[model samples]
Target: PVNRLDFGTSGLILFAKSAEIQAKLSKEIQEHRIERIYYAVVRGVPAAASGVISLPIANIDGNRRINEGGREAETFYRVIKAWQGYSLLEISLKTGRTHQIRIHLSYIGHPILGDLKYGVKSDFINRPALHAGKLDFQKSEFKIPELAAALPEDMAGLLEALQA
Candidate 1:
């Protein structure tokens, strides 16, 4: 696979027709030529409408944590909508470290809804209220059009409930 999504996170996974193509696509990802966009419902609203979360993450004892000496990771997020106790966010990744989104959002005190490991469990959804909404390859040499995936039923239902 060209990229991966965390176990409970729903998203797009790129695959190659051959090993050679896989290597090339992997290189593109490593060079930050591909853009990944996500939609997430968080527990609370952020203080800012949009901002970047530049923090390093390290896997300690099988759990990801924010550590000063860890590998550099960056996540960008903008509040798309806010409700009484929840906010919808449009998120992008500058670096894709394991569990980067979950950790960063939790660190900022607005963990994704239903992300039990990073945040409190939710009654709205069974898994993290996150979805890989779009994969943009405009910057890459490959002439493929952008790819997008709609939110799964569970996430869509959660959003509907939140909106009401």
Candidate 2:
């Protein structure tokens, strides 16, 4: 999950159907064959329509931190929709690490809408505004199905309010 799904980023997560599939899938992850699409609610609008975030990530003790000495992590983000002081985003991760998206977004001053750890002060929805909207995978002998999870109630409710 992208930096803790908080209490709201509930969506598709791929699980291997068998131990053999799990082993193969694990290997594919290292090769970067697994793809993930995330949607997020954020405060304020981003200046650019879309861009890439390249940052090194390392596990510092128990927390993930951005550092010069860590492994490379990349995130691709684009604004999907916006209203008032908020915007929806489509995020893709090139390299998966703990908290990669959250840390990267926060570093850029965007931070997910209700993320408490990174810094969002909203009491109405006090959790990271992220969801694993889609997943795609490739395998040689077998086909790993593409998956899509529906938006959670809170996020849906928020969107409903915004639309209304």
Candidate 3:
């Protein structure tokens, strides 16, 4: 696969037919040519409606956390909606490290809702409320048009309840 989603996260994934294609796609990803967009329902509204989270993440005992010596990770987030105590975010990544979104959101004090590893679990959803909503390959050599997936039922239901 050219890219993978975190275990419980849902969204578009890219797969290559051959090793050569995989290498080519991997290069595009490494060069930040592919656009990845995610939607997450987080626990609380951030003080700022939009901002960037630039932090380094390291894997320790299989868990991802912010560490000064870790690889550089950058996450950009914009608050799409805020209701009750929760906020919906549209997030993009500059660097795709393992668990980058989860760790960055948690570090910023607004962990993704139901993300037990990084934040408290919630009744609204069993797994982290994150979905890979869009992927744009326009900037790459592949010439594939942008692809998008609607939020899965679980996430859409969670949002409906929140909006109620």
Candidate with the greatest TM-score versus the true structure? 1
Q: Pairs clashing in candidate 3?
A: none
lDDT digits (tens) for residues 120-151 of candidate 2: 75644656778888767654344757777888
User: Which 10 residues in a row give candidate 3 its minimum summed lDDT?
Assistant: 115-124
For each candidate in turn, the TM-score is 0.97, 0.84, 0.95
What CA RMSD would you report for each candidate? 0.9, 3.0, 1.1
**Backbone clashes per model, in order?**
0, 0, 0
Error of 2 at 106 (Å): 0.6
Candidate 1: residue 31 lDDT (0-100): 87
**Better candidate number, 1 or 2, judged by TM-score:** 1
lDDT of 2 at 46: 84
Give stretches of model 2 more than 4 Å off: 1-8, 138-141, 162-164
* lDDT of model number 1: 0.92
Q: Give stretches of model 3 more than 4 Å off.
A: none
lDDT of 3 at 98: 84
Q: Worst ten-residue run, lDDT, model 2?
A: 1-10
